[model samples]
Target: MDVPADDDPFEAQRERASNPMRRLFDEYGRERSGTFAVGVAASVFARVLDLLPPLMLGIAVDAIFLNESEFSLPLVPDRWLPTDPETQFWLVVGIVLFSFLGGAVLHWFRNWGWNRFAQYVQHAIRTDTYDAMQRLNMTFFADKQTGEMMSVLSNDVNRLERFLNDGLNSAFRLGVMVVGIAALLFWMNWQLAIVALLPVPLIALFTYQFVKTIQPKYADVRSTVGQVNSRLENNLGGIQVIKTSNTESYEADRVEEVSGDYFDANWGAIETRIKFFPGLRVLAGLGFALTFTIGGLWVFRGEGPWLFTGTLRPGEFVTFILYSQRFIWPMAQFGQIINMYQRAYASAARVFGLMDEDAGIEERPDAAELVVDDGRVDYDDVTFGYGDETILDGVSFTAEGGDTVALVGPTGAGKSTALKLLLRMYDVDDGAIRVDGQDVRDVTLASLRDTIGYVSQETFLFYGTVRENITYGAFEASDEDVVAAAKAAEAHEFVTNLPDGYDTMVGERGVKLSGGQRQRLAIARAMLRDPDILILDEATSDVDTETEMLIQRSLDRLTADRTTFVIAHRLSTVKDADQIVVLDDGEVVERGSHEDLLATDGLYASLWSVQAGEIDDLPAEFVERATDRGARAETDGATTDQ
Candidate 1:
C-alpha cells in the first residue's frame, strides 16, 4: 500500500489564483450560472446607492449657490410650479423622501440576493465534499488524520462561508465604488479629478505588496493550527491510555509544543500586518492630505471653473471630500479582503485534495451482483502488501459450503488480511478472490459485503441504545428477533441486567461496557445479520476465560450450518474445526485436522503443545475434574467398543 503521490495539475493552478475571493465566486458558479449574474447586479446596485450621497451633496451646493441654477427638473417648465417659494420647498422635500425610499429598497434587495447565493454555494460544497469522502477508499482514511478531516468539514467550510457572507460581495461592491467615484470626479472637473486620484496607484501598490507578503504567512498559520487540532484529537481519543500510563504530563507537553508552534505562526502573520498596515495607514493619510491641500489651493486660487466663474462652493468641496472618503475606505478593506482570500485558498487546496483522492478498489463498469448459493470461497495465489513489505505471498486456500476452517497464526501473520480480501476492503496486489466461483472484483461491493458477517477483535459500537447496537446490521429486526440473536451470542443475561435493559445507551465505542460485554454485543450484531459466510477474527481474544466459554458456545451454534473462517491465537477454540491452517511469515507452514496436524509435529503441533501445557498447568482441582471427564469418556468408549 504505497500511497500514491498527489499530482493534480489543477491543484497548482487553483492555488495560484490572484484573488482567492474570486475562487469563492467560481465555486458558486458551479451550481447556478445565474448566481454570479445576480451577485454582480446586487453589487452594482449597492454601489450606485453609495454614490448617491456624493451626488446629493453636489446638487444641494448648486441649489444654495446660484439662485437661478437651483436643482430642478430640466424637462419641466418653471411656469408649472406654484408662485410661492414655500410650495417649491415642499416639492424638494418630497423628492428627497422618494430618493431615500428608493435607496432603502435597493439595499434590501441587494442583501437578500447576495446572502441567498452564499448559502446556496455553501450547501452545495458541503454536500459534495461529504459525498466525495464516502467515495474514497481505506487508503485515504489511513493516510489522513481524523482531525484534519474535521478541520476541512468545519473550519475550512466556515472560511468559505465568511468569504461569501462578506468578503466576495464586499470586494465587488468596493470595485464598483472605486470606479463610480473616479467617473464622477472626472465628470465634475477633469483636472481636479486627476489630482484626487494621483495617490491611488501608490495605495494599490502598497496593498498588493502587503497582501503578497502576508499570504504565505497565513498559510503557515493554517497549517500549524491544523497540527494543534490533530494533537488535541489524538489525545482526546486516547485519554484512557494516557490516564492508565500516568502520562498526562507528557501528553500536555506535546499539546503545548503544538500550541506554541501555532502561536508562532499566528505571531508571524501578525508581524507582517504590523509592518504593512502602518505603512498602509500612512499612505492613506498622505492621499487624504493631498486631496485637501491640492484641491483646496486650486479652489482658493480661483483656477479653471473657479477662476472662470466664481469661488468654489462649500457644498461642492464637502461632496468631493465625501466621495474621496468612500474611495479610501474600500482601499483600506482591500488589504484585509486579500488576507482572507489567501487563507481560504490554502484551506480549499487541502479540502479539494481529499475530494480528489482515487479509491484503490473500484467496481468495473459491467460488474454484476454477487449471487450466493453454495457459499464457496477461494483465494487464488493472492499476493498483497500494505507498502513495500508483503503480507500475503502467493497464498491459496478454499473453503466449501458448510465447512468450518480456522486460521491460527502469530501476530501480523496475514490472517486478518486474508479475511479482509474476501470482503474487498483492499484489493490484492496480484491475484483474485472469488465468491461462489465468481471473481469478487467482478461482483458489486455492496452485495459481496452483505453476504459476509465479520466480528473483529476490535469491536466498534456507535453511541446508541443496546437494542440499536444489536440491530445495527438488521435494522428491520423485530424486538423478539433481536432478543433471540442476543441469546444466541450469550449477551441476553447481561443486557437484561443493565439499568435501562434494551434501552441502555452505549457510550462512545461502547466504552461504558466491559471488554467481554462489547465482544458479546458484537457477536449478537453478527448473529442478527445471519450472513451465509462468517468471519470471526480473534473475536473472543479480549474476553475473560469464563466469558470466552460462553462466546464459544454461541459461535459453535452459529457456525453449525454455515461456512466459517476463524482467525485466532487460542488453539483450544478451534480444536474441533473441520480444518486448521497454521500461517507464519506470510505463508502456510502447516494445515490439517486437529489430530492429524498433531501427529505431523509441525507448526500446529508446536502451537497446540504450548496451549495444552498451559491448560494442564491449571489448579489440581480443575485438572482432576478434566481427568474424571476423560475417564468417563473412556469408559463409555469401552462399553460402546464391546
Candidate 2:
C-alpha cells in the first residue's frame, strides 16, 4: 500500500525541527528553577577552584622573587615573614594542600549535582512522552506505523538520554572550565588574556558553520533510520506471507534499499564530522601556539608594561598559558557537541511530534458512566465515514435486551462499520447512539467498553499461557471462573489436552494454537468478561465446517441473556436471529423476523435462498407455515404480495 504524503506544510516544518539535540538547552532551562540551580551552584564552585592553581602559581612566583612580599598582610603591608626558610616553606606547603583538598571537594559536588539534574530532567521528559502516547487516539495509530511509534519510544528517547548523560554534562563542564580559565588569564595579565582569546570568536564562527552544514545530513540520517525501522517492521510482520509466496528475494531487495539509504545518510554525517573535527583541532592547536609564543616573549624580555607593573610574573605567565590550554580543549569539543546536538534535535522533533498529536476522540466534560440496564441499544439516524468516504448512511436500529440481531451483507456493505459504531471505536458523524437510554458519546469510554464484549474474526492473543489470555480482561477471576468460562466457550477440553494444560504458552498472537483453538480462546476471553452486550464479527467465517459447528454451539450458549450483534456473510447464521438486517451500499434494505423477511421475497430473501442453497432447503415445516402466513396476508390485503 502506498502511504500518502502528509499535506500540511506546518506539520512538515514541525517534523523537521523536532531534533532532540536542538532543544537540549530549552529542556535544561525549564528545570533551572530547581535542580538546575543546584547544578549551576556546584559548577560555579568547581570553576572557582579551577582558578586557584593559577593564583597559587602566581604566589609561588612572588615567594621566589620577593620572599617577604608574599607574606604581607592587608593592614600591615610592610610586615615580613620569619627569616627562617623552613618556616616559610612549611606555610606554603600547608596552603597548597588546603587548595588541593578544596578543589577535590568542589569537583565531587559539581559532578554529583549536575548528574542528578540530568537524570531528573530525563525522567520527566520520558514520562511525559509515554503518557502522551497513551492519551493519543486511534486515528493517530491509524495514520502512523507501529514501527515508527516504537522508534520514538525506544531510539528517540534514548538519544535524549545520551544527550542528558554525556552531551549536556560535557557542555556544562566545558563552559565552566573556559570561564574559569578566562578569569585567571585576565587576573594574571589582561593584555596576554586578550591575545590568547583572539582566536575564540573565529572558532565560534567555525563551530556554528559546521553545525549548520551538518544539520541537514543528521536530519537525513534520522529519516533514514525511520525508513529502515519501518521496513524491518513490515518484513517481520509479513515474514510468513513472504515465505509462502516465495518472495524472499523481493523482500530482501526492499530491505537492502532502505538499509542503503540509512548507510548513505550516515556516510554524509561522517564526512561532515571528519571535516569539521579536524579543522577545529587545527584551530585549537594554532590558538595554543600563539598563546605560548606571545606570553613567552613577554616573560623573557620583561619589557611588556603588564609584566613591568609587577602584577604579572614569569611563573604566573606559565600557569596562565597552561590554563589557556585547558580552555582550548573545551573549545575544540564545542564542535563535537554541536554535532551531537543536531542529531539529538532531529530525534526530539519526531518524538515531540508524537507527543503533540491530539486524540480525536475524547470524553466530554459532562460524560457519565455507562449504566447497563438490560443492554438496550438504539442507533438514531447514524452516519459515519473515514475521511470523505461515507461507510454508513443515516442508519437507525433498535435492539432490546436479550435480543440477537444478525447483520448479513456483502463485503464493504457497512456491516462491520455499524458494529464499530456500537463499540464506540468511532463516533457517528451525524447522529447519536444510545445505550440503556444514555447517549454513548456522553459516557466514559472505560465504562462503555467494559459493558460490551467484542470478538473479531482475527483473534489476538498475547504471548502468555492459556489461562492468562482467557483471564486477561478479568484478571481477578478465580480458577473456577476461568475453567467455567473456558468450558462454556468449548475451549477447556482442548486446553486441558495441551502439554501444560492451562499454563501452556500461546506464543505470539497464539501462533501455537490452531485456527479453531485461537478462536475458542478468544471466545473464552470474551465469555469471562460476561458483558451485557456482545459483538461477534464474522466469528465463524474463517473456521472449517466442523469447527464452525462447535463454535456455533458455544456461541449459542454465550449469547444467551445478552444483547448480541453478529456480522456475518453466511445467511444461515442469521436465520435464527430475532431480527435479520440486510444491508447494501451503507443502507439497510431489509429488516424483519426470518419468516417475515423470507415471505417478503426481497433482498434478504434472495440472499437467504442463495446462502441456504435453496428456498425449500429452509425447514420444510417452517416453509409451509411461512407459505400459509403469506396466503393469509395476501387474502387480507394488509401486506404487499411477493
> What tens digits encode model 1's per-residue C-alpha lDDT throughout 548-615?
99988888878878899999888888888888888766788788899999898766776676677745
Which candidate has the highest lDDT of all?
2
Runs with alpha carbons beyond 4 Å of true place in candidate 2: 1-38, 54-58, 61-124, 305-312, 605-642
Query: What local distance difference test score does each model get?
Result: 0.76, 0.77
Per-candidate total of colliding backbone pairs: 2, 10
Tens-digit per-residue lDDT, 1-642, candidate 2? 111234221145346454444465575547644666666676676666666655655556666555624443223344455555566556556756777788788767766766676667667767887898877665566656666667667777778767765776678778888887887678667887887888799899998888888877776776667778888998898889999999999999999987887798789889879998888878888888988887777767765644334445576676777788888878999888777777677777776676666666779999988998888999888898779878789888889999999987655668887887777777889988999889988999999999999998888999999999999989999999999999999999999999999999999888899999999989999999999999998889899999999899889999999999988878787789998888766888888898999899776776677676776555565466456756755775652111
Give the TM-scores of the predictions, in the order they appear: 0.86, 0.85
